[model samples]
Target: MMKKTDGEKNKFSLWLLAWPIFIEQFLQFLLGSVDTLMVSKISDNAVAVVGFSNQLFNALMTLFATVASGAGIVIAQKIGSRKDEEARTVAIIAFKVTTWIGVFLSILLIAIPAPIATMLQMPEELLPLAKIYISIVGGGMILTAMMSVLGTAIRNTGNTKGPMMIAVGMNIVHIILNYCFIFGAFGFPQWGLTGVAISTVTSRLLATVVLFLMFLGTFERKMGMKDFSIFDRKLFKEILTIGWPLGVNSGSWVFSQLAIFSFLAILGSSELAARTYMSTLESFCFLLGFSLALAAQIQIAHLYGAGKIKEAYKAVYRVLAIGLPLVIVNAFILVLFGGNVLSLFTKDQEILTICASLLWMNLLLQPGKMINMALGNSLNAVGDTRYTMIVSLIFMWLIATGCSYLYGVHLGWGIIAIYACMIVDEYIRGVLSFVRWRGRKYLRMKETELERESTKFTESFASPSM
Candidate 1:
């Protein structure tokens, strides 16, 4: 095999790695859209019930996501070091962590789904629908959690395509099942909210099985308690050293968003509907940037792990350069075409208009958002997650969350005003990230040197430019 050179980015190869992620994310992105549509067909109240209740899942996932999300950096490093066994071990630990977390979440949510509904002050008209949606979705949280960790491991190992294909298949199955079960098509029972839940759980179960079977039958990899016991004390320190900062960074940012969501819940049911639809649209709109960000991380983590700091530096910007333009273009698509897109989610003219207005707001915010995503992911990939955590805390908590609270709740300026605060927050973080990159604060000497030496050869390769 030919040697790989430092700082060399095969745009094609990077995209090849990224396309599967893009497709995976695309299908995953459609999840909310599909669920929203399926339940909306049952009733507008069902839509709110389903939408509001999803926060519980998000809140639960937040606690355990680091187990999975932190695995990618470690896996990428192992691959760069050519230590597939270690990568496999990390994957096993991650699986165990999330599996238990999922099981607990399933029990907790199922036990108290009703109380959660009441706590959210969920629209009374939609409480029953909410209960059923929460019961089914929360009951099956284990399956979804399995899907998340394993999928992240799969993607991290440079085998994204298989999972993407499985995601597409499962998505199609879910949509079809939803149609049949929700409306009683094809002689299926017309179960409405319960039907949608059944379809979702069943599809997620299939996705988990397919992913596991792929490892067993195709990849021939098995993870268990034995594998988890092969602990890497050093790597554990490394993982947490880098991963915990990232966890804090990501948590701060996400919590801020959740806080804003909570604020909107108070505005009224219609506001909640508008926020949900806008959020769904934003999910799709943001996919391009996220996929590209994943590509950047994979590229940066591998190249940097292989002691190619110079190339890693160039790679981050190259990936960002490619993604930044796409973000701008996608925003325009949302601006020009958002009306038609939101219409697919709702028949309510007023709700449709609210979503459209929100889409335009998103378009204006995309450039800033793109900068933040590109820089943040790239920075974290290099294990400089402390910066991410600190900056995110400073900005998200004090600036973003505070601005959102004062305007949205205190001033009673409503959802649009709330978003205006968010736009400011996005740009502020975006600019700060850009500035951090220029100052090299995101890539300090200690982490870079440690990473470089980890894979650096005492003896050089024959071809420096391989």
Candidate 2:
């Protein structure tokens, strides 16, 4: 009974961290859905253009996301080990470093918008609109970067609700601004895609500023600019060491998804548009699994840092058991109302039918996906990122994209076939990740790395050699 009580307490803690993240992600999705639905009003081509542009932006951010992931892992573990100052230092360095990266990226993308559009293989008709959208949003990449880092930092400190509230407020402003600008409502000029871009950038900038203030006021660690100033070269290197593999993992998935998109592009705009719509619906399922996984990752990192490997192992199981069924339920609901959901995006009957069929396939696909997501998150937190990264690269490039090309394009099996290959990839990698976590290898690796960090931290203080 005591054991069961403790399990329930841990489960409550997991949801405490997770629910806010889920709300934030859901709002973010609604922001995008609003943009897509509004864009669809102008033209299906418009929707496709924005979809491709957003993907490009996300892929580009994958580089900076590495820093965020690295910081989160290091900070979470450091805090767990009762090293509050060290965790604060990691947060500041991450903010400073990723902010600069975001500035450079903003300038680069805005300067060469055409090349970005070309790289994405934008349809000829969609190229101009895509360029316009990218050019505007590209300039605000710094705010987006800062917001992401701040959100991660705060969440690591176990204050997920702060970021979630900020997101809710920001997305509300975004929708209102989009409505006014996109349609020329309330005497605003109808700027179309330009308006959508403006709304996105403005909202993110606002969110970033508010989140920064909240970070300063709310976190128990109480960081200062000085904490960010003493750049520990060793710690920075450690961050990169943890971060790059995670970055590669993100980049691999981005490129593979793009490859599949390219295949869909060959089928024409309607199909691509249908895919964009279907993917938005699918994101709800992704959010359910991913939010829980993130919470699990943080809890596992804390347990490992505190030398509770057995508890960490149990935590992963608990996360998986909870997350997987939620995803299955989310998929089931999507299948039930997918047709009605597709109608929100467009009136094309054929596209609607294709999207509905894909929703049915999701009932099978999402459980495997949830398993992969949950375990992958847990592995990365434990400093076992390399295994997950390598597995992702191998399966994504070789099995997922390779078969996507062969079956989706060459054999003309259409988008469903591409999705089938994707499900195959998820299950394969998911099983491997689960197996790795089931063994003692990941726990051993975590122990070694944490011990090294603790030693280095102690020596640095003992000698004061700077």
Candidate 3:
């Protein structure tokens, strides 16, 4: 029998992880699109409300997702190093930490909905609906947080199918509930924006339950009460050491986005809704790139942990090589069919015109966006998170937000100019991240960290007090 070459094995691993994740994220991204399409039929104000509510909800969710991000990298490395018990323990810790954070944030959002709505500059007419939507989904964030950690951890172990199944089932439930509640179908009362929120929360809650059962069924791989009973100081510190920076990185992006939304509000809610529709369509392109990037991250993490640093580096380029062109072609098609796509949401000629023009800009934006997505995930997976965070803060805040306000608001260059400024941000960061990848700083750091973890894992098993 012939043995598989290392290259062939790597190819199998990448595809094994990538395709399921792509399908999962596609469905997840579709949730927002479905909400926007259905809400667009209700009223322009309702559409704008959904847009703002989504932004705020996503920002908070990103913050809650930090623990999962850290845990994912650690778990991936542990699995690669063949330390299954340690990986399972880290997964359980991640579940607890994120769930507590989610509960806290839920209460905070429920209590301060008005402040959040005001911060997003939600229109006065839409503010009431926005508050209701945020409160319901925000209050149910514990479910979202748990599901996120479970999905990330399992994917790190090369079980992408578990999360993908959950995402598919949950989205189906959300769509059905949305149809019934949003329009009073099947004797259900019309709930409008509030209905969307309820559907989102309820569906996510179901995902959490399904994920828990799925995670538990792997008897040899399962984590138990004992794993949660004893506190591991090093584990907690590792989680925090990696998690806090990710939280800050995600927070900076969300805040800068809110600032951009505030700037867009000046152009009127119609334009805000237009931007929302355009962004939803653009997410389709990104879903392809982002999923491939994640596949690269998972493979790279394992290779780095197994001390195959050179192979890890090569894996990154291979994924980017495929992902970049795919996204470019996808963006081109989106530009070609821009008007027809926009018409799916609303018949507003002005919004459609503006969205079509933005699709042209997407031609320039998607390449740079793909670069950033690929390298940024690679950097984070190898534990060079702080560098990416610094880069992101600088470009997203100092460059993207500054240019957005100056061109879009002060100069009155409108949405196109703001998008142009954003492109500049994307290219700048993309080039910088590419350069960082070339330098091997993260590679060296990962080598040291993996060695230390190997020692720690061995000691923990031998002495139980190490």
Candidate 4:
């Protein structure tokens, strides 16, 4: 068992946990942005292909996120309740489950990259590059899965710094490798998109290895082969119960985004490239809220596990209070300066004009997204995932996808109108999530369960020892 101390407790505070996650997330965004930036040098078509392929990759990652999210919440709660053994068991199960899923996904993507790319309505000219990038990176899903599970396990233990350090190292390696392969530096052939994909996979492989070693050192008991062999049905059920909704929720967002991407593909390469560039810049604004929401999720899970229901409830509000303003400020900065940032990638006036309009729309979009993330994550932490999942499924498809088709495609309102649809979706879902949290239903349910458990304990003690 890792020794608990004042320092350890202090590390669980929102700010301490969030800052490292924020940096880690920033580096992650940088990793993708760098890929897009470097590849944009090849051509805007290359950037479009890269962005399209990544959206598919992200959709597949929801499978891994299912396991990671489930396991992370369970581990945090178990640790909060001081059930270290259970927490460790959950971690092992998560690793085992994610490995199988990752392998299957890797094979699927690698074997059928062409078909998948075609189904996503990838442009004919882009198919060859898309296939290569997808196969190379997609073949490495196992490494990505391992990294996701390992990072989630480590962070939920309130040791966000370890993952942050790993990300910093991985990103450094990634940039160097990207330069060598993409630009034909260090005597390497200029592989272009293929080189970027290879660099991504290689960097992930290194980070996964380092993360596994760090995972071994973090826990009290050493993990052996037998640990992997062991299966706990109840714990597995708990993980799936919490994880599937999260997976579906994430799936809803990614799939809807993919649908929207296909719509942009119809709009032409200029619109697609513009959307790609804005996504990179807009990530900076939203990641602030995402990092804070993730930290609050961890903290809230711990509090809920320890039966501190009120504290858990208040923690969500605290995160909202802190996160919303920062996200708003960040969005404003992006709106003001996003064009300069876009200029770093492209000089095309049409793309720049499209991206500028999107940034203004993003200012309206981001605050709602921030609110949704803060509240939705809190609900997930307490195992109240179904509501958020349902809300996401309904609104994301209806408002996000349906309206994009209606306003952007069918009515030919264009990309700006598509963004307006998205903004409406975010606020509607955010408001529903807020109402769900405010109702205190999850807290009441948890309290009832605790009382029942208390009754059982009393009954056991009152009876003769058997």
- Top candidate (lDDT): 4
Error of 4 at 245 (Å): 0.7
The residue pairs that clash in candidate 2, if any, are none
Top TM-score model: 4
Which 10 consecutive residues of model 4 have the lowest summed lDDT? 1-10
lDDT values of the candidates?
0.76, 0.84, 0.82, 0.90
* Deviation of model 1 at 38, angstroms: 2.7
* Arranged by lDDT, best first: 4, 2, 3, 1
Give one digit per residue, the lDDT tens place, for model 1 in 1-466: 3433332234225787888889888887877587677777777667766667776577667666777777778877677756777777777767777789899989988898888877856667667777778888899999988998888787776677888999998888889998998889999999988988889899999999999766543222665435555666666666667777777776777667767766777777777888877777777766877888888888777766655667777766776788778877888887888788777777888788677677778876777777888888877777777887788899887777888778778999877788777888788887877787777654467456765765576335544766
Please give, for residues 316-410, the per-residue lDDT of candidate 3 as tens digits.
Answer: 79878999999899899898886787888899888888888899899999999999888888888778889888998888987789989988999
1-466 in candidate 2: lDDT tens per residue? 6795465345337888899999899998888687678888888888887777667777888879899988888887776776777787788888899999999999998899988777766777778887888889988888888987888888887778898999999988888888988889999999987898899899888899899988775445576666657687777887888889998998899888887787888877777888888788889887967898999888777777667788888887887888888898989988888787788889988888788778988888899888988899889888888998999999999888999989988999998898899989999999999899888697887678778988998998989665
RMSD each, Å: 4.2, 4.8, 4.3, 2.1
Clashing pairs in 4: none
- Superposition-based RMSD of candidate 1 using all C-alpha atoms, in angstroms: 4.2
Model 2, which residues run further than 4 Å from truth? 1-12, 218-221, 445-466
